[model samples]
Target: PAARVVLVERSPEMAGFAHATLAHPGNAHLGDRASVLTADVMLTGKARGEAGLADNSFDFVIMNPPFNAAEDRATPDQLRKQAHVMEDGLFESWIRSAAAVAKPRGGLAVIARPEQLGALLDAIDGRFGDTEMLAVHPRPEAAAIRIVVRATLGARGKLSIRPPLMLHAETGNGPAERTEMINNGLASLFGD
Candidate 1:
């Protein structure tokens, strides 16, 4: 059977955008394999289950939760600010939800600012293991802008950090080959 996806979105506009994107002719197959549920992701496991996120059912969970500190320069737009700013306990809540829904040995992947890696790891502790992180740098000499973390539920393997992914060429403005490949969906952070 084809893999099915259940997307949870809190914003009506985003939900509508998701639906419209899926409904596009080029994405008909994806639409057939996916469904969108409009709801708060911060809800309790039981509440989420009631909203169609059954516990111990999903084989994989991926997220790009807001990681910006409240003190970070806020976006002028309220909606964008809300989407980019992180609230207290956000990581814990999201990871708790991920753990609840994922089957044993299920995979969890997250994209976050490099500074949030510690918080993310702490939240995953005792729930997901065998964690690996890949740093995303804007250029060869620049500090990492983001990190992609991957882990497996119920596994005990030690954490590992993968090679950094450079988005831009060492000295040029254009994107690196790998970055282009990844942007085009031809590659993955996990090298899978």
Candidate 2:
């Protein structure tokens, strides 16, 4: 199962990590099957022909887009502002970008704040359908903090909402194996 992986990062830091990971000698076996592209997909996604990203070329695309539009604060940190705050239709732009590269009858998945569910669906609009959603709660009976949605391109079937995924158990332990691995310094979401 060495499925080809294409990582597109808008942030320089993320892009660097992806590039290094793919290019590292440890992963040299992947060779041309993996790629890391740095671009602001929202603005230039349609014009990435030079990057060899052709239209409807991918079987599936997954995205985690910025959900906040905290524009009123006027923060001085331009990078943080650009990363968190959203201009009008920014979510739509990201969704459209993903749809443009997804193959027909393929799939798209997005993870975003539970509060942004409406916006997420609206962003995909008519581009994708047959939506399925899973709510992620921090604890049992807790309100959902995040939502994971998957949909098929060009399929307009009725939407289905699945059961929630509780991160913490009733004993208050979170993702047992992952937590243990992290505590042992054997696994991490961010690497050294």
Candidate 3:
């Protein structure tokens, strides 16, 4: 709780929702320690500086950049479409932004669709090294649907692929007994 968390989101509506949720009675404990800044981090400048974010100054950077190229959909929500639809060079821009602000030896993480892992690695190739990937699957027997890539800036090392993190039990397995510890924080893969 000693560290401050500043969330940067490009969507104004989403950023407002984050602020409102964090200020809600049940989660108000964040108090003033957490705040959201609406900005396109890829082009952050005066806004970033005002928020105390300087080039190569952040301890780490985490990005959930949009990964899907424009897709045909029925949703009428323009905001949702804008958020999910990706443009050319979006990933590269996001990776560059993270590298620009990350301190030397600082860590960076990007959550992306499984198909984009190669592009993600290429984008971070020079600015971040010692890359590792954690694949996330819906269940132990399912193929990974996404990956979380973690890297250290300015380090030299080989890439490591970690075991997949399964999010659910397989069908017909029945519900595994969950203890308070498990429900609260303990995570497992149904003993798989």
Candidate 4:
């Protein structure tokens, strides 16, 4: 059987769009395996369960939470602002919710700006362990702009910083081969 997936979105419009996209003919194969849930992830576990998220049920939870600092320039568009701007303690709140829905020994993966690494690790400290980080660089010599973290719930392994994933080449040709492969779903950033 295909793995069941639930895409939780706070924005109703975005959730509707996701549902429609998943229901489209092009995604027919995935239509039956995935669902969209329009609900606030900040809700308490019981509240979330009432809203369609079963507690301690998901095998894994993957998220890309807004990481922009409040001091950053804000977008003029309300929707964009809501989606891209990070409010106070939002990161921790999201992590808490992710942990709530994850099963014992389940995994959690998060991608965010590199600056958020410290906060991210702090947020997941007790809830998820065996943390591993992968830096994502724009080019070979460039500093990492983003970091992808993977951790297992209820684990105790020491954190490991894996090799960096370069998105672009120094030659300015285009995306690196690994990036292309990942974008096409032909490869995973963390190998199986």
lDDT against the true structure, per candidate, is 0.90, 0.77, 0.78, 0.89
Model 4 agreement with the true structure over 99-170: per-residue lDDT tens digits = 889998999999999989888999999889999999999999999999999999989887999989999988
**Whole-model lDDT, model 3:** 0.78
Score candidate 2 by TM-score against the native.
0.79
Q: For residues 42-151, what per-residue lDDT tens digits would candidate 1 score against the true structure?
A: 88857888977888999999998878897794778877776889989999999999999999999999999988988999999999999999999999999999999999
Per-residue lDDT, model 4, residue 21, is 96
Query: All candidates' TM-scores?
Result: 0.92, 0.79, 0.84, 0.94
User: What is candidate 2's local distance difference test score?
Assistant: 0.77
Residue lDDT tens for model 3, 1-192: 786678988788999999888889997788887888887776766666665567887788988887776763435788887778777788788888788788889989899999898899999998899888888777777899889899999988878887666656676444333322345557532221
Ranking by lDDT: 1, 4, 3, 2
Cα misplacement distance, residue 169 of candidate 3 (Å):
1.9
Please report the TM-score between candidate 3 and the true structure. Answer: 0.84
Model 1 misplaced stretches (Cα beyond 4 Å): 73-78
Q: 2 or 3: which has the higher lDDT?
A: 3
Comparing 1 and 3 on TM-score, the stronger one: 1
Judge candidate 4 at residue 6 and give its lDDT: 87
Deviating ranges (above 4 Å) for candidate 2: 24-31, 44-46, 71-75, 176-192
Q: Residue-pair clashes per candidate, as listed?
A: 0, 0, 0, 0
